[model samples]
Target chain A: MNLKRLESILDDLEGFSDPNIRYEQYVTPSYVAARMLHTISLSNHIEGKMIVDLGTGPGILAIGSALLGAHYVVGVDIDSSVFQIALSNLADLDELFVGQPPIDFVESDVTKCVLKPKSFDVAIFNPPFGTKGNSGIDVSFIKAALDLTKVAVYSLHKSSTRSFIVKKGEQLGAKVEVLGQFSYDLPATYARHSKAVKAIDVDLLRFSHR
Target chain B: MKLLTHNMLTSRCLKGVTNGYPLKIVANEVKTENVDYNSEFIARVIPKVDWKVLSSTASDFGVSLPEEPPADIESNEDMLRKVHHALLEIEITQGDLICPETGRKFPIKQGIPNMLCNEDEVK
Candidate 1:
C-alpha cells in the first residue's frame, strides 16, 4: 500500500530466480503490461472473470491482471525459472485483491497445456518472438493461445510476421484487431551486438472469438 | 538491442551468403553507462541468451568471453563483476545495423533503431 513497502516487495520479486529453464522469456515491461490490462478492461467490461497469460514470463501481466481484478489467472510457460520469478512477483499482489483469483504458474508448452475450453473470458500473451539468435513466431503458438479464450490480446513484433498472424487468426475464425503500438530501444549486452537499437514496434492485437 | 530482437534477426542481407544465418557486427558507437544489473535478473536471463551470437558480437566489440560460463558464479566476485559489465554497461548510440538478409539498413540514431521499411519493402 505504501511506496517504500511496495518498492521492497518488488525488490524481493525481482530477486527471485531459477536455472534449467527454457522458453520463459521477456518479463513484459510493467508499464506495457499495465497498459495491456487497461486495454482489455476498456474493450469489454468483463470484471471478475477468468483470465490467462499464455507466456507469462515473470508474471507481470498475470499479476497485473490480478491487481486489476481478474477473478482468476493461470500464467503458463515452458520455463520453470521464469515461473519462479512470476511466483514471487504475484506474492506482492496478494494484498490487493479480496479473495483474489488464484494465480498459478504452470511450466509447460502453452500449445500442449490443457485448459477449460471456452472458459476463460480473456487471454493475454507477450510470447517469445525471438530467442537465442532465433525467432519463434509460428501459427501453432497463436492457435494454442486462441483455443483457450473467447477473446485474446497479443503483444507482438510489428513486422511482416504481423500479416502472417492476422491471416492465421482470421482463418481460425476470430476478428483480428490491432490495439496499440510502441517502440523500445533495448540496450545491448557484450554477447549481443545489434543493441536492439531499433524501435521494436510492440502491437496489442485482439482476437475477438465470435 | 534486446535479446528478444537479436534472437529473431537474420543476416540475409550479406552479399554472397545464401542464408546469412548470422549478421556480423560493425559497431560504431558503443558506450557503457547507466543500465542496472540485478543478479537475479541476469540469472533468470542466462538461459534465454544466444551465447554463440553473444560471444561473437562481444568479440567484434573486442570483449572476449567464454562460450559456456561456469555455474555457481554468483559467489565469484570477479566473474559476477564481468557479467555485470557485459549485461548492462554497453550502450549503442549511433550506427547502422545491417539485416543479414536483404541487406536492409536499420539505423540507430541516439540509441533508437529505426526499423521502418520503405513502401516497397512493406508491400
Candidate 2:
C-alpha cells in the first residue's frame, strides 16, 4: 500500500482514552508514523523482516510495518487496555494485505521481557519522551532494542536529546544517525498544557549496529 | 509460543541463572494452523535463529528438524518449507517454560508466555 492509503487507515487508530502521565503516554501521530515507516521501507528494511514494536500504543507502527510487507510484526505494550484497540485497528486493515506477515501483540514491560537476543531484524518504538517526571526512559528503551536487534533500531525522541542519545549510542558501540525531524502534536491530555494541542519537535534517530 | 519465539527466549534474567538459555518446554497442549509459506522470509530468519535450541525444542514437540541448517538454505526450497512449518505453523497453546538453571516456570496461556518475574527475581 502507498503512504497516503496507509496514513489514512492509521488515522482511524484509537488513542489512549485516559492517558497516564507516569508513562508519558501519547499516541504517535499517523502522519509521523507513516513517514517513518515509509522511510524505513525505502531503505529496503521492511520487507521480510522480523519487526518488534516496543511500547506499541494502539499498534500504529506495527500495523504500518505489516502493511509494508514485514515478515512478522510483534507489538509489545505494558498496558493491556490498548491491546483491544490495537486488535480492532489491525482487524480493520487485515484484508489489505491478504498474505502479508502475521502481527501479534504481547502485553509485557519492554525492559523486563525475555525476548531472545539478536532475534529481531529491526526494533521500532516511539517511546515516552521523558518530559513528565519519567526521565531517561527513552535511553532504556534504546538499550533494550539494541540488545534484541541484529540490524538497527528506529526510535523517536525529542530533538533536544540528540547529544544524550549520541553518547548512549557510542557507549553501546552503535552508530547513530538523525534521519529526519518531524513536529509532534502533543494533545493536551493533561491539565497542565493550556493549549488544546502543543507542538513539539521530534527526531527520528536510527542506531545502526556496527 | 512457537519454537521461533522459544528459540529467542532465555532465562538469563531469572535469579542465579547463568547461561539460562533454551528454556525447557513442558507443553500441556500444542496446536497447528495453516499459514502461508514464504521461502524468502524463512531464509532470512534462518541465520538469526539458534539452530541447536530450535532443533531440541522441536523434537520435544514431536516436530522433526534437521540437526543443522543447510549451508545453501536460501536456494533449498524443501529446507525452507520445513523451517517455515517449524517456526510459524506450530503453536504452543498452553505450557510452562522452565528456566534451565533456576527451574522457574513461566506459564503460557492462549499462546502468550508470561515472562514477568517478582521484584526479588530481578537482578
Instruction: Assess the local accuracy of residue A210 in candidate 2 as a C-alpha lDDT between 0 and 100.
Output: 94
What TM-score, computed on C-alpha atoms, does each candidate reach?
0.53, 0.91
- What is residue B119's positional error in candidate 1, in angstroms? 43
lDDT of 2 by residue, A1-210 (tens): 788987888898787777777777778899999999998998887888999999997889999898888888888887766776777787677567654237766656788757877879899889987777777888889999998888999999888788988899889889999999998778785324689987888899999999
- The complex in candidate 2 yields a DockQ of 0.46
Q: Write the per-residue lDDT of candidate 1 for residues B28-121, one digit (tens) a residue.
A: 7776554334455455445544667766666566567687766776566566556545544555556766766666666655443444343344
Interface RMSD score of each model = 15.9, 2.6
RMSD of every candidate to native, in Å, equals: 17.7, 2.3
TM-score of candidate 2 restricted to chain B? 0.94
Retained native contacts per candidate, as fractions?
0.00, 0.37
